[model samples]
Target: MVLTDTHTHQYYETDPVKKAELMQRCLDNGISRLFLPNVDSTSISQVMDMVDTYPDNCFPMLGLHPCDVKANWKQELETIYAAIKETKVYAIGEIGIDLYWDQTFLAEQQQAFRQQIGWAKAAKLPINIHCRNAFDEVYAILKDEHNQELRGIFHCFSGTLEQARQIIDLNFMLGIGGVVTYKNAGLDKVVEHIGLNSIVLETDSPYLTPVPYRGKPNESSYLIHVAQKIADLHQTTLETVARITTENSKIIFGI
Candidate 1:
C-alpha cells in the first residue's frame, strides 16, 4: 500500500513540532513520497527547508505560480530560474495561467508559463501545471511547445473527458486529487473514460481536502482518501490504484 502524493504544499506550517507530527501522519498513512510545488520566490526557502528536514520523504519543485504573476513577473521568474539551475528540483511546476481570479495579468502569466516550460525542457525535468479557467491558453502553449522532450502532469485536474484525452494526447498525466471525491465534482465520470495509467494521485494539501474531512485543512495523510475515491470510481482496489499511480508519478518525476 505504498502511496505517493504527487502534488502537495506543506511549506506554510513553520512549527517544527507540527511538521514532525504531519510527517509521522503521512508515514503512518503509507504516503512515502510527497512532491512539493513552489508558489513563487517567497515560498522557495520554506519548500527547501521542508525537503531538507525530510530528504527521504519530500521533494521540491521550482516555478512561479500563475496567480503569483504580477507586474514584476519577470523578476520573479528570474528567481525561480536561478533556483532551478542551482537546486535539485524534481519538476518545473505548479505553473500555468489562472483567469478565474484576475484577468489583468493573463499575458504575463502565459509568458511565465512558456518560459518555465523552456527551462524544464533545457533542464530535462517534467512540469507540474496549475490551470484554472485558462485551459485553452495553457493548451495552446502546450501544443506549440510540447515535443518528445516535454512531459509533466496537469496538477489538480478537474476537467471533461475530452480535455483529459487532450492532455493525454500531449503525453501529460492527469493529476487527480481531493476534488474527485466531491459530491458533484463530475471527476468520477471523467475517470471512467480514462485508464489509471493516465492518472496520478495528489492532495494539493492545505486545500482541497477529501471527503469526511472536507472542511478541515488537508494533509498528505488524507491522500489515502483520494486514492480510495479513484479506486471506487474505477471499480478497482486501493492497492492497484496506489501501485499504478505511484509508477505513473515516477515516470513523470523520475524519482
Candidate 2:
C-alpha cells in the first residue's frame, strides 16, 4: 500500500543530519509523498529549502499559523501574500484560530485567518486549517466565507461527529492521524461513522506520534501505524485504508 503523509514538518531544524536521516527513513518505509505547512514568516525559507531539496517528494503550503499571530500580524500576512505570489504553493495552510495556548492575540488570529482564507480563494488553492480549542470561532469564519469554491483539509481534526458533518458540508476533508490510535482519543469513532473517503492520512510529524511510539518523535514512517489503526477501527484492511486515503489526498492537493 502506498502511503501519503498529507501533513508533516520536515522543515524545522533540530539537526540537519538527523532530519536528513529521518527523511530517508520515511522514504525507505514507503512514505512517498509529504505535504509541509508553513509555521511562520521565520520558517518560510527553511520550508522552501526543504521543498527545493526534494521537489518531487515534498510539497509546501504557504500561510501564517494562528499561534504565530501577534501585533505584527499585518506584516506577516504581507510576507505570506508575497510568497504566494512568488511561489507555486500547493495550498494556504496551517492557518486558523487557536485559543488553546494563548488568547492575547485572538482578534489578530481571527483577522489573519480570514485574510489567509481570502488569499486561498484568490489563489484558487485549497486551505489547510489548524483549529485548536476554537472550533466555534473557526467554524463561524468558515461558515461565513466558505462556499463551493473554497475547500481544503482540516489538519489534525479532532471534533465531534456534528462538527465533522459541518466540515464536510463546507467541502473540506478531515485529516486523520496518530491521535486516532490513542485509547481515549475519539477519532476512531469519527472514522467509524464518517468512513475513509471523508478523511485523509497524516502524521503531523515530530508532534502526534501514534501509540507504542506515542511519546516519541513522529516521522512519516509512523503513518503506517496510523493507517493500520484506522483500518482496524473501520473493520477494513490496511491496503483499503491506504488506497482510499491516498486517493482522497490526491484529489485535495491536485497531485
Candidate 3:
C-alpha cells in the first residue's frame, strides 16, 4: 500500500533529526511519495533542499501562493519564474485566488493567478491550486483557461459537491486533505459521492491536521488518517484508497 501525499509542506521541518523521524514515520506507514509546494520566493530553497535530500521520495513544485501576492508580487513571481529554469518542477502552484486572509490585493491576486496559469500551460505541467474564499473567482479563471494542456489539482479542497463537479469537469482532480477527517467539515459528504478517480489525498501539513490529532501539529506521516477516513467513507479498504489515489496522482504529476 503506497500512499501519496499530493500536496504537503513537509519541508517546514528544518531540523535534520526531526525531519528524518517524520519521514521515517511516513515511509513506515507506506506514505513514501510526498509532493512539496513552495509558497513564495523565500520557500523555494527549503522545498528544493528537502527534495534534494530525499530525491526518490520527494518531488518539487514552485509557485507564488495567492496569499503571498503583495506590492512586490511581480518581483516575487520573477524570482520564482527565474528559479524554475534552475530546477525541474513537477507543477506550477499552490497558486490561485485567496480572499480569506485579506481582500486588499484582489486585483493583484487575479493577475498573478492568470500569469501563473500561462506559465503552467506553456510548460505543459499540472498546477497545484491554493484557493480560499475565492472559488468563484478562481473557477472563473480556470474555466477561461480550460484546454487540452490545462490540468492540475485543487489543493486543500473543502468545498461543495457542485464545486467538485465543476473542477472534475475541467479534467482536474480534487485534492482531499485532513479536512475530510473532521467530523463537521462536510467534506466527507462530498468525497462519498465523487468518483474516486477525481479525488487525491493530501495532508497540507503542518496544518489542517486530521482527527485523533486534529488539535496538534500535522505531518506527512499522518496521511494514513486522511486515507483511512476516505476509505471508511467509500466503504473500501485502506489499500484500495491508497492505490487509486496514488495512481490518480501519477496521472496528474506525470510521475
Candidate 4:
C-alpha cells in the first residue's frame, strides 16, 4: 500500500547528504509522496530546491506561516503570492493562527490567514493550515469566509470531536499525525467517532515524531509508525490505513 505524508518539512534539512538519506528511507518504506509547506519568504527557495531534486516524490506549497507573521507581513505575503504566480504549487499552506508561541502578532496572523485564504481561492488550490491554541479564532474566520470553492486540511489537528465535525462540515479534511499517538492526546476519541475518510496522514516532520521516536527529529519514513498507530486505533490492518489515508490525501491535494 502507498502511504502519503500530506504535510512534512523534509526540505528543512539543509545538509544535502542527510536530506538524501532521509528521503531514500522514506521511499524504501513505501512513503511515496511528501508535501512541503512554506513557512515564509525565507524558506520558499529551499522548499523549491528540494522539490526540484525529487520532483516526482515531493510537492511544494506557498504561504506565510502564522508564527512568521510580523509587522512586515504584508510584504512577505506579496512575495509568497508572486512565487505562487510564478510556479505551480501543490497548495497554499502551513498558514494559520498560533497563540501558543506568542500573541504579539495575533492581529497580523489573522490578516495573513485571511489573505492566504483568498490566494488559495484565486489560485484554485487547497490549503494546509497550521493552527495551535487558536481554534476558536480560526473557526470563526472560516465560518465567516469559507465558501464551497475553498477547501484544505487542518494540518496537525489536535482538537475536540466537535471541532473536527466543524472542519469536515466546511469541506476541509482533518490532518492526523503523531499527536494521535500520544498517550494523553485524546485524538483517539475524535477518530473513533469521525470516519477515516475525513482524515489524512502527516508527520509535520522534523517535528512531532511519533512514539518511540518522540523528542527526536522526525522524518517521512516515520510516517509508518503514525499510520500503524491509526490502524491499531481503528482495529484494522496497516495496509487498510495506508490505502485509505493515501486516497484521502489525493482528494485534498488533487495529486
lDDT (0 to 1) per candidate: 0.93, 0.89, 0.94, 0.90
Estimate the TM-score for candidate 3: 0.99
Better of 2 and 4 by TM-score: 4
Model 1 lowest lDDT segment of ten: 78-87
In order of appearance, the predictions have TM-scores of 0.99, 0.97, 0.99, 0.98
Over 1-255, each residue of candidate 4 has an lDDT whose tens digit, in order, gives 799999998888999999999989998999989999989898999999999999999999889999999988999999988899899898998899999989999999998899889888887899889899999999999888889889999999899998999999999999998888888989877887778888889999999999879999889999999889888878999999899989988887788
lDDT of 4: 0.90
lDDT of 1 by residue, 1-255 (tens): 799999999778899999999989999989999999989998999999999999999999889999999999999988888888888999998899999999999989988998999889988999999999989999999999989979999999999999999999999999999999998989888987889999999999899999989999999999999999888888999999999999999999889
Which one is best on lDDT?
A: 3
Q: Judge candidate 3 at residue 16 and give its lDDT.
A: 98
List where candidate 4 sits over 4 angstroms from the true fold: none
Arrange candidates by lDDT, descending.
3, 1, 4, 2
| Candidates arranged by TM-score, highest first | 3, 1, 4, 2
Q: TM-score of the candidate numbered 1?
A: 0.99
Q: Residue 97 CA error for candidate 1 (Å)? A: 0.4
Report the lDDT tens digits of candidate 2 across residue range 1-255.
678998898677557797788778878777888999988888888889889878888999989999899888999889888988898899898899999999999989988999999988987889999999999999999999977789999999988999999999899999998998988988778778997899899999879999879998788888999988888888999999889998998999899
Error of 1 at 11 (Å): 1.6
Could you tell me which residue pairs clash in candidate 3?
Answer: none
